[model samples]
Target: MASEDLKEDQEVSFCLNLFTLRCGHSFCRVCINQVLNTKEGSGVYSCPECRAEFKEWPSLQRNVTLCNAMENFISNNPQQEEITGISCTYCVHSPIPAIISCLLCESSLHNNHLRVHSEEAKHVLTDPSSSIENRKCSIHKELLMYYCTEDAACLCMSCTLAEEHWGHQVEILDEAIERKKEKLSDVLRKLYMQRQKTEERVQRLEECRGRAHQKANREAERLNALFTDIRNQLDDLEKRMHCEISRQEEQESLSISDLIQKLELKKDELSRNIRSIEDLCNMPDPLTILQEPDMGDLCDPEEGEGEEVTGYVDDPEQEEADEDSKGDTGGDYGFQQILHTLSNIISDVNVVFYGQRPADILLDVNTAANNILISDDLKTATRTDKKQNRPETAESFQCFQVMSKERFTSGRHYWDVEIAESGICWVGVCYPSIDRRGWQSYIGSTNKSWSLFIGRGYRNQCSVSHNKSELMLPYQIFSAGVRIYVDYEAGQLSFYELCDPIRHLYTFTTTFTEPLHAAFCVWNKYVKV
Candidate 1:
């Protein structure tokens, strides 16, 4: 029981107002003061635990380390009223509260035990519960005071002298940690900025997608409405054709009905005459019969001729022939009617397609052939046998065909070319990308060209080299002026004879795959635009 009481008192010893003398022995400050007061005239003080004497009442310093240890110990074991005093971890000793901890040895020891432990182990010591023992090199059992910048770890002085860390740059641990923290902060700032930009890009893409979807929907609705209108027109045309046929049939039926009514009237008149003759022949008295109306006039053939009635019979063959002729004429009439309607439609479309639009007709001087001379107005071109002295350029056409400056990729256009009297030329349009040096550049010679020839006969050709299919116009049309019309949207190229009444000569139809340029080939003749 006495030993238990001593142990308990030792455990709570650090919690009191403690003081340490030069001999490194700790006791309560009040107890130390009482001892000092009793030895006032002795001119000397003594340590309670070590029994070491000091000269002139040795100065006692407060044990701050022991006070901190006591606070930590109490806080950690708050539920327990008393603590099992810490024992010396290095040597066998009775339980006592520890005041110092060895960092290298990782153990807590009392003052007496710490002196012996530090001498034998050469371990660094600190206040108990300070956790300095954890900051030691495991391999060398030394305090880690330096940080290896290359290895990015805390290291001891012994490690810096070893082969592994030799010549490696190092800094103090606190300074290294501060530099790493600054670098990490910069990285975090850059990451935040990148995230913001990515979010903005995602938002923009979403807006673009939404707009595209809306435009597509609007176009689809417009197309649907246009197709619906086309279908309605077709239906109306069908109804009109059927109604015209029904009207023709009704007119023919009325003619037949009139013929029947006339025949019936003639039949009734003849029957009345027959009944009159029978009554006169059946008279009982000869005098009464002779006296009965002009019997002599009836017997006289010449006089009766005027009284005789002849009923005309309808000719079945004649009726059939008439009907056959009407049927034969109806086919041609229907065909012409359809042609007329289509012509009207084309005329209406032309107004919309070519309404006061700018003319895309300009001569490119760079593309003129060496032997060709262009008028000052840039509207006429003429070829001569003598080659003009002009510098060679990429845009110059090696062949006779020179492309116009303006290129057409869409929309409609019309232009007229007046051929010089008795002069021949080729006028039309060609793709700008066609070979300018080879024979393929010639108008109507390659697939990229379509032209009307005003030479021997007015003929139009398309890719004549591959397939020679040319359409000849009338002689009158050749003598007259020529007009070229293009509906690029519909892929139509039409030539017309500019006579009193314009006559369509020929038309070339194909989907234009590239921008087109009006090309002219003046073969030893002048052609005006």
Candidate 2:
């Protein structure tokens, strides 16, 4: 009866393959199939435990819940115990689980047994494991106590005294483990700090990118607003010109209309005067003609006004030419106005800012390279054939280079340098920390400096270089020399050729971390700033 009850309980338990009947009862597929096969010919069958009736033809649906639960249960339970692992030897009678093992006794103990276990320095307690044989030296059959530093392995006392490890450095196994743990902890701390620093650098880079995007957006917005205003102003200027021409046209038309009205009245008066004269000449009665008013009345006192009207009507071409003459004058006037306003607008857009630009930039003698001669006023650097007797200093340059006395750390600054008309030279900016020897010290060859190199030939090919990368600038004529401008905080360096209208030569951009000084490299010529 007990076995039958247990089997019934197994029908609804979690298993690998399970299926549910129409009545919501679950059972393993194997057991359900085995029981249904017994009633194969019967068309219907009854559930084993619930006794629920079901058609033999009913489709079986796999129970997914039971499959998943079965997977988890099997993975975590019924694990085969390791035969070599230590168990509760002291708990042999009770057979309780072992929690700790004693190396001195080679036995595992439970909590109650450990309360009465021997308390000795040699009794090393640890997690219950089958390490009795592993803990001892296979050759000596003795428990390994000391650690051999030379061989990086555990050693038994007998092995430590033997010929193999005779004079090698050794420490207690417990002490060695502790020391290793301490070093590991220290290394872990350093790794954590390194990770923190990396995170901070990443965040800083992201912020820089955000700020750059904002700056670009602001510049675009400003330009857009400015252009829109310019367009509106241009539109207003055009409207004002049209209005002026319209006013001129209106005034000329009104004047011509008034003259035409006067001409019509004068024509009627001239016609009446002629008709009266013809009547007086046709009359035969001299007395009747004499009876008319005095000669002043017959002649008409307003005849002079009519003569003026007749003069304007006789010169039709002249009248037409006179009309709207002021309209042409107004057009000329608007043209001058348009030209003047455009010139002013252009000046405002490209307004030259000469603020804080040093007029006289002096050279530093200490940083001058070999054979470089500085003028007494320190404004000029000349490359001489004869080397001057100067003491070698840390700040001195090894090549044909020189630096300015003035160092720029912040704000915008620009200085003009007059280069030799025909010679190879370099004009750029460099940090004070530039290398003092080898090719790296040459201007434009290292990351610490930026330079523009002008060639010796007629074309005077110019190239800008930084960190060993060079970009050749399109050849252009230079009349005066070159101008160097630097915005330290903005990390912008620009070189402009002092030609007509001051053409921009090149520009370099970077994040400057140190103060910068103007750098110059010249040979076979002199440069003045």
CA lDDT scores, all candidates in order? 0.67, 0.74
How many residue pairs clash in model 1? 0
Which candidate number has the best TM-score?
Answer: 1
Could you tell me which 10 consecutive residues in candidate 1 have the lowest summed lDDT?
Answer: 304-313
Tens-digit lDDT track for model 1 on 9-114? Answer: 6564343456677888887756776876787566566776777886654655667687656655555644321243445565564566677677777787777775
**lDDT for residue 434 in candidate 2, whole number 0-100:** 95
At residue 48, candidate 1 shows an lDDT of 66
Which residue segments of model 1 deviate by more than 4 Å? 1-145, 256-529
Please, what are the lDDT tens digits per residue for candidate 2 over residues 1-529? Answer: 8545644554554445567777788777667768876765675788887888865334456666766666555555433234234468876766766777887787888788899998987787877766666777889877779999999999987888888888899999989999999999899889857865664565466457646645665556655655565677789998998898788667766766777788787789878978988898789999988897664564566655533332133467766665457356533337777876675444333323323545357899999986899999998898887888788889898868899888888987888887777767888988899998889998899999999887653577889999999998886545557778776776778777665344556667689998888889986587889
Using lDDT, give the best candidate's number: 2
lDDT of 2: 0.74
User: What are the clashing pairs of model 2?
Assistant: none
